[model samples]
Target: MTKPANTQLTDARRGDARADRTTFLWTAAFIFAGMTVTILSAATELQRANSAFPVGKVVLYEITGFLSFLAMFPLIAWLVTRSTPGQHSWRQVIPVHLAASLGVVILHVSLFVLLRKALVPVFFGEPYFFTDNLARDFIYEYRKSVLAYGIVLFAITFGRELEQKRRELAAAREDAKKSHRLTLKCGGRSIFVDASDVIWAKSASNYVEVKTPGAEHLARATLASIERQLGDAGANAVRVHRSWIVNADYISRIEPTGEGDLKIEMKDGATVPGSRRYRGNLNLS
Candidate 1:
């Protein structure tokens, strides 16, 4: 019994460890991709100043960029994961990008002596000291380019993503509004109804019987206008039958009950039939 229990516990622990690894990889990839774009933008800007394209200078810049990208990994990971809002919102990405850009420049400055020394052998047959003339201009230009381009790249990429998220949020809010429940009281009577909550409504000349939640309501509203309102909310408030508008959120279990009958079990313990014509609406939602 103890051996079996230990085996099960070990398996569960391994599963949890794997999940953590996956999460870390995803976070790291997002950070790395952003940094790559920033670095590449800097390279593009340097390329545009093509008149001063020094082979030695470009080679030296490549080495510095490689090292900066490597150092930026841990810096970005720390900034994004350490903050509370960073873990949940896009706000974390802004700080991470700033830190990454700063880290690249700072690391270049701190390791200038060593980087220059290493590049001497790569660009020239013989190794040279950091005090050489070749190291001076290359280091100066490299630092200037990294700062200017890194910010540009981060702003463009991050701004695009932020705008995309904002649009998605706006669309979701519009959808929620269409299906949202509203409560109103008039003449000592309280009424609560959602546009999508109405399963069916019938015209009684001047009054309408609105079927919703778990009861029927007599409200003074036009069915045509209500249908148009649901459309503004989202595709979820689609009309199944001419008289019925069902809330897709309440649908829990859907199954075929017979040759031509389909049963939908709702979260509120209500049963609604899914007709052949309405099956297309279910797919839309």
Candidate 2:
């Protein structure tokens, strides 16, 4: 039974949504793991140096910083998707990314400072100050933020490319599976013919005359177009002339004409003309 067009479309949308959710979760996991390791390393270094900052306070500061960066990830992902690397010229992509990175740096620093100011005094007795010099702190944070932007951009870009490749491979496999069946549309009617059942085909004006064991179909398609539709089955179905394509599996005999052309007889008792120009393309064992 054939499925309704709306149901097929809905299923496709659901599949896309599931794939997107999976990609998002994987990306978040990688970012979280990296931030966790960084936080641990920072705490360890501070303890080893005997810094006056409490270890718990340091951990809290790092957590807030990580959250700020995480919050910026959606914006970064949007920018990357809008101006993909290979899709756009470097001149165009570079300026967009640069501007976005600056915006991200400013937003990230502001968020991180706000989170610290709001949480630090509640945890500890003293209020938190990001730095003594505002200008210097902003510049320092910008340097690190830009690096983070680059990393996030690369991750999203690579993930999209990988997903695209996976989809292409999957589509190719599905096409291969469907190649064994040809759908022929005539007027308001549709016919499905197995590739192996096809004995021969010939060009008829704009249409292709496809012959099967006990049926003939005049599909509104060109010979070349119908030939491509055969896909993997094309190996057995060869173009013996400009207007003719014959199935070697159904060929009973190939007789050469005195005029350098050939007469190919099918097991279905049909005959197709073969041009010597395309004779090399046909091989019968």
- Return the top candidate by lDDT: 2
Cα lDDT over the full model 2: 0.79
lDDT of 1 by residue, 1-285 (tens): 124988866754454344434444554465557556665766687778774545556546555655544444444334433432323555765565555656555565556557766776777666745445656756675577456435434333343344444443444345446556433222336465665666554444545566666787775545544555455544356455545556676667778767655677767676666666667777633
lDDT of 2 by residue, 12-121 (tens): 55554455556667766876797789878888899799988787886787788888988887788778767878878999999999999999999999999999999989
Q: Which pairs clash (backbone N, Cα, C closer than 3 Å) in model 1?
A: 178-233
TM-score top scorer: 2
Instruction: Give residue 261's error in model 2 in angstroms.
Output: 44
The residue ranges of model 1 lying beyond 4 angstroms of the native Cα positions read 1-56, 84-105, 126-285
State every prediction's TM-score relative to the real structure. Answer: 0.32, 0.57
How badly does each model clash, as a count of residue pairs?
A: 1, 0
lDDT of 1 at 13: 48
Q: Could you report the Cα RMSD, in angstroms, for every candidate shown?
A: 14.6, 12.1
